[model samples]
Target: MEQQSLWEATANERKERQALQGEQHCDVVVIGGGFSGLSTAYHLQRKNCQTIILEKESVGFGASGRNGGEVLTGYIGSMELHAKKKGLEAARQMWQLSLDSIDLIEHIINTHQISCAFRRNGDFHAAYKPSHLDGMKREQEVMERDFDYKKIKVVEKQDLHSELNTPFYHGGRVDESSAHFHPLNYALGLAEAVEEMGGTIYEQSEALSYRKESGKVVVNTNKGRVIAKELVIVTNAYSGDFQKTIKKTIVPVESIMIATEPLSEELCQDLIKHDRAVSDTKNLLYYFRLTADHRLAFGGSGRSSSKRDQENLFNNLRAGMITVFPQLKNAQVDYRWGGKVGFTQEMLPYMGQLEDGSYYAFGFAGHGAAMSSMAGKLIAKNILHEGGGDNPLEKARLRPIPFHSQHAKAVGMMKFYMKFRDRIS
Candidate 1:
């Protein structure tokens, strides 16, 4: 019951990689060392490209390491809504891409021989209110008719007890294509694969600035400068001011999680009979799943952002756990952690080159485990001129959020809206 991530605690010790030293050069320089960056570097290395990855901290130190590890299919927003707005054919392609993203994860795990306890146990989208079932029904129908997808099945309130031993949910949908895994281990495995393929990764080396000079992209870091013919930015929610324009196009929201001490096997079986990852239908959602060692990893968002207020945040999360399963009221909490997720106005991820010709991909909302990996591969394909097809996100215009300087205030307002919506709906 350590005060750290269960994945980090159990993962194998990572060997240190050297940081960038004065004035190095490569064919491509990637900024950030999370899933997106590591995946991109791995694929690029496979194509015989000389690539180098720069990380502000160790690999996977950002959301990639801290996530709940639910590798789910599809984007954050409603597929039905996307179909209506962007046409059925377009929506179907996007849906297929999401499924392909899941396939990509399995391929990486199998190909790289990664031992991250990858499991395709499926995912449950529980309805917080009865009205939410109607949308699930519509989504299922759309997936079947328009996309020819049939892995998802609607679970009635009566049948939900068999899938999950919870009285809080009215009904839900289960998709068998989704999965859970040790996210940190997966990222580390990719880092190892990248190095094995002759690519270099520099930890603790933050990219400070980048400029085009003499037909090359010169990126300055705290340790050294990297000159390359191409550059890729995969910072996601940790973008900070590194790329000012891209940062403005996304909103970083804090997502907090807490893990309980290992429950008895019988209790774990009773809590989630099918061992599926679960997420409720609320603007401020709660997602949970059982870890490999049988710990209940529960997480959600809260209003406060202060680190000093963690005790209150932990209490709030514990109350949420009890609300979902009162049997866990006496369970001892083990770990408490939080990370930021980037959300776009459309609630979908964006990928493409910037006005300066540098490639970039981000804004996956909270459904990034699969999407981020797919995005990295796609970005590399685009860079190599391998014809990865036209990415819809690339067509999206990067629009800055209004009053971007008041992000904290905006998040406060969003919390209020979510609470009101949860109450009325």
Candidate 2:
């Protein structure tokens, strides 16, 4: 079976951009052509900043296009824990920012008329165990009492049938503010918008290294170089050795996804009743949603980085899907793909200027679709002197993770521990 991304296979055709040639000068140079870079270029160009985007591959070839298409509107970790660590006031601000991220995506799609099958159908956080439902109840209460946010509704085990036809979950919580979309198409649309607004993008042009020269930053690629007043590194998981400091601060993990052949409309409705994206409460969570063509797109933690592991990942995802919805027992998987996700020590996203005087953002965990786009806008504001520095995310520093070279082994051990705990609990 061939491994590919459903998003890439279905995404609209985009005009090919030639690799950078000779030398070019711009007000800002954004590295990586994923959501963050494209978004930063779009926002900067709208403000008449001479911006150029350098992409190693075609646009959206990285995590931005290969993600699970979940436009979630909150933290992946516990909200109450976040409130306890950072004062309630700080937590409140972060919560609002999360909501604003989703809003920005909707605004961009509407403003640029992006045809990415965008939908605000919300999402469901399922309880893998009976005790998990109790935690969800507390989360709902905390959001209402402390954050003044009450959009979440908890479904009891008895009432869970209305949401999903699965006995694997005991209950779940629904967040009406969350959404889903065709991520690759969205990224392509932003690329087009950036060009329309006078920003130039070069495909197959990777930033090999960069250095500060005088007051400007000089980025070098194999074919050419860019000299700009400012540089933004949005490479995230693909930042391999390009910047040692930033690379040390991030742990890149792989995530695998599979898309099943299109099911009958009736079967799709039976599987995901309300057509909302669904994720389970587990250390290695199971997230799945219905595609526009009625196919089930399922994803989970990937075990290894080896290309030979693709078959293993596909089997794992298919088994997980069948466990949740036995009706798909014989469903044929049409596509299988994997992408890297950046995780920080804090397990939260961060954005700020590095010691090298370059702006950067990464460690979105799995929330890049919404958070990364917001990071782009914030980075643009920082460049334009628009008070973006006031945000909490901008104040945090990306500290290097100790023993960074052993990330794969460490992640494997952690996954083993988490899986054991999940089984016992």
Candidate 3:
């Protein structure tokens, strides 16, 4: 399969659109033209709602453009976490939703005929330490019994090391229903599909302000404004000052990644028997996978919600990658990039209507890509009142931490605590 390099995959495949110049009118205004915004606008336009997507930068410029490209259901749901909030039965449905998100992503690729190296091989979550394996085991037991999720299977040290070609992993949990692909390509493809469906996309038209007048919300960009009956905030962590309420509601986490020069076919095949992405079990972990070109794109993105020193986040992440995949100690790093991910205190993705026609969907916890794309559809469904496609999560509320200080000290303290924990271990 011949394709452009992973970093540049979406370059040639993007659907270019003119930026918003002057005042414009659209039925719905979608902020942030990434996966969440693009998919939402695409689906909304398909429903014949005259829609316009307002992109802060180019489409796929944020996390949608930069992510581990790992599609898996082990992130399906946490029984422990869900049980604490919504109980066991609701958690079971949450598990199904995670699995459904995986299926929905693949379905979009097939139905839209998007050529983003879409594959259904599977994904592996490996253990960085012995304790991590226990967490994996707990995950396996509850998911299998509660949701009848048989797609997940465990691989012991011997089998995992052989398949992963990494000595640091103790074992791994494999999910058959998940896969990986070029994320930016997928996001750009979704935007293209939206245009094909007669939707208008306005790039570089950052939403700087919004005024809710009457039933219409006027979205003001630098050069233009859209008076939309409904508005969707799909910007995630990049929402910026367009909406102070949204900006204050969530925290942005910095994620870093790197791409390596192409490897020998034999070496690539030896590294991963099949074509699935792998992430380890660490608070800050290493995620990597083989591309269609036989090169390895490993993720070592460190997160900083509030601004902090980023002088050497890449170098630290690369060092972490070598620690996990020591075999790649000498691999030539080709591209290093970073982006932000929004997270809510609840750890569940915040999805709900802010008002009658205004929707908020961000905070996909730590996993977005496919899940964020799924969220876009949900936003469209709620706006269109097509309740069938709207699931139980349509009404999920935001649970903010009582004391989420933005001084950046909160994360710094967490980092200090983690370092101490590691030292103790």
Candidate 4:
């Protein structure tokens, strides 16, 4: 099996760019070249701003390329929970922003003419238990009545077989606004668009540190230095100790995925009749979708330990796939890979300027494809003195994870807790 992302394997030719070799200056410097950073640069360049992107690796080498490519519509948590934590109006705004994020993805694809196999085929939030279906119904009602959103259709258990050819799911809900696409292609296309608009991108240019000097932020890198009026941190899960506080704010969880060899057209049609992306209601949930090339791309939250045995990981994921689609028990796994996802204590993403005047947006948990792209544009608008501060996430207090000092132990405990919760629920 290829030890690479299916998206990367199928992507078009990638544009090569030189690394930062000397001192540079720009209006803003974006660290990381994933969706958030690239999208931020794209928007800023369109506004005629001088922007510089510093990536430790090639553009889209991080979660931007490694994700499941589900363009979902909502935060990690439910709208009801958000409303209780914040207010009803605030939750409504957040939901509206999520819907807007989906629109932004479509806009970027169309304006850039990105041939990333973008599709609005919708998504299935499958229920593992009867209670999960009840929750879906309640959520759908709340969304329709309170937020005036009605794209979701609740599928009863009796009608579940018509939507999915699996008895594993009790029922589910369908959100037609959601989409799936080739993630790497879209990221590369965004990079091309950024360069076309006069933005500078430097690969293998890892940012070492940053400090304010003469009313400007000077970023020290491995190969060069960058001085800019503002800075944005878009590293997300790959964020190491670049900023100590930011690192503590999120727990990086490993997500593993495997893509099966192209199945027969009849089998693919039988597997997912509507070609809709699917995710189940479980603590360590399984998400699967029919790739543009007719392969089954299945993924899930892996073990807490980072040093996972590849063979074991593949076996576990294959078993999960077989549980959902028994016919896939003998299918050959073509690709197996893993990536990290940043999860916040609140289980939602946050975006705003930091105390040091450096902007940041991270902690998407597992739902980031659309949100990160939208965050990039919003961050750019905020830097331009536009009305981008209205986002409710800006008001959230960034809290570090409990027992973060004992990282490994804490994560192990978290994994145990989740497993226990899943068992009881």
Any idea what lDDT model 1 has?
0.86
lDDT of 3 by residue, 322-418 (tens): 7766767788987766777676655557788764447888877557866888788888888888756436555544444444565462374346435
For all predictions, the C-alpha RMSD in Å is: 2.4, 2.3, 4.1, 2.2
- Predicted candidate 4 versus true structure: per-residue lDDT over 137-181, tens digit per residue: 988998899889889999999998767899898989999999999
Model 3 C-alpha RMSD to native: 4.1
TM-score of decoy 2: 0.96
lDDT of each: 0.86, 0.87, 0.74, 0.87
Number of the predicted model whose lDDT against the real structure is largest = 2
- Each prediction's total of clashing residue pairs, residues at least 3 apart in sequence or on different chains, is 0, 0, 4, 0
Model 1 RMSD in angstroms? 2.4
TM-score of candidate 4 to 2 decimals: 0.95
What lDDT score is found at residue 413 in candidate 2? 40
Off by over 4 Å in 3: 1-6, 74-77, 303-311, 355-357, 388-390, 394-425
Q: Provide the global lDDT of candidate 3 against the true structure.
A: 0.74
